[model samples]
Target: MPTVLVTGASRGLGREFVRQYAAAGWQVIACARNPDTMGDLASDSTVLQKLDLLDPATITALANALVDRPIDILLNNAGTMGSQSFAKHGLNVQRFGQSDYADWEHLFQVNVLGPMRMAEAFVEHVAASKRKVIVTLTSMVGSMATNAAGGLYAYRSSKAAANAIMKSMSIDLAARGIIATPIHPGWAKTEMGGPNAPLNPVDAVAGVRRVIDGLTPEKAGRFWQFDGTEMPW
Candidate 1:
């Protein structure tokens, strides 16, 4: 069976990815910051491990634990919206010069640095597997060409950085036959995506899986929407 390792598998879109992949008979390596709350997901996977993106030790340990295992797909799915810092205001827009630097740093750590670390650590594992794909969940807000409104300073910039890193990885890992892409999961109705959002986790994940299924080495480094449309920058 093909194996997928998903980070942030405790709740929301990450949890749904675990459920759908495991249900489809994939050998899943489900990871979460805290695995204690992952009841059914733990029982359903080939392995359950603690993988906090903020914690470098955990990243190193998880890499060590899976060193012998070939992972077909490594999903860098964990992220922070940095909404707590902007909670009193909102994420859509912030006052000029009022953005919190700490929140920006935090978002970059999880959304950019963490996934880059994952790719660095797991490149060998993925290259040895059947599919050989690395996917990070990014956003359309990251697109420089599409930034017409331009208000979500921290969230948007972090995702943009993520896209750039994945693009570089696509080129760097090409010879090794590893395909990397940053995917936009749409405005899914998850914790970050509020209840009024159009898509649900199930549908969103299904679309993303289809996109993943269709990826070839030729398609590496592109930003893609969940519905299979190519996104800008």
Candidate 2:
């Protein structure tokens, strides 16, 4: 069985990815901050890795744990949107015009730095895999040129930063035969996307699967929507 490793697998899209990949006969490595909270995942013989994006030690430990194993796909899906403080939560906080940098720092750590660090730490392991793919979950809001509706502050900018970070990884890891792609799962109806969001997790996940299945190394580092549209940076 091909092995797939997903972060933040206790809920939302991460949970769906775990279920789908496992059902498809992949050896799933499901990582979450609380493995105890992953009762459903634990029952499936999926490798439950406890990881907190806020903790560097935990990240390092996860890398060390998987060093010997080949991981077909590494989904850098764990992230945060912060509290709905409007300006305080987003652009303003990012520019140092805010009261609480707490959420801002947390968001950057999780949304921006976390994926880069994870990909860096696991590049060798993923290189050893059969499929040799590294996919990061980004957002349309991350597109500075396309973000028409404003106000998600930290979430928006951090995701954009993540896109840039992953771009560098794609460039550097290309010669190693790894294909790294940033995908916008679209307005997925997850907790972050809220209940009124347009796309269901299953449909969105399918779209992502389709993109991954059809993508080539030549397409690496591009921004793609769930439906396979090329998103502008």
TM-score winner:
1
Cα lDDT of model 2 by residue, 1-233, tens digit: 88888998988899998888888888999999998877767645488999888888888898897788999898998878776533233333333344346887888999878898888788888999888999999998899998666656677888899889878878998898999989999877777777767899999998988888887888899998889999999
The 10-residue segment of model 1 with minimum total lDDT is 85-94
What is candidate 2's TM-score against the reference? 0.91
Off by over 4 Å in 1: 85-91
Model 1 steric clash pairs: none
| lDDT per residue as tens, model 1, 1-233 | 99999998888889899999999999999889888777667654557889988988898898888887899999999988875533233455544576888878988999999999999988889988989999999998899999888588888889999999999999999999999999999888877787777899999999999999999998999999999999888
Which candidate number maximizes lDDT?
1
Please, what is the whole-model Cα lDDT of each candidate in the order they appear? Answer: 0.88, 0.83
Per-candidate TM-scores read 0.95, 0.91
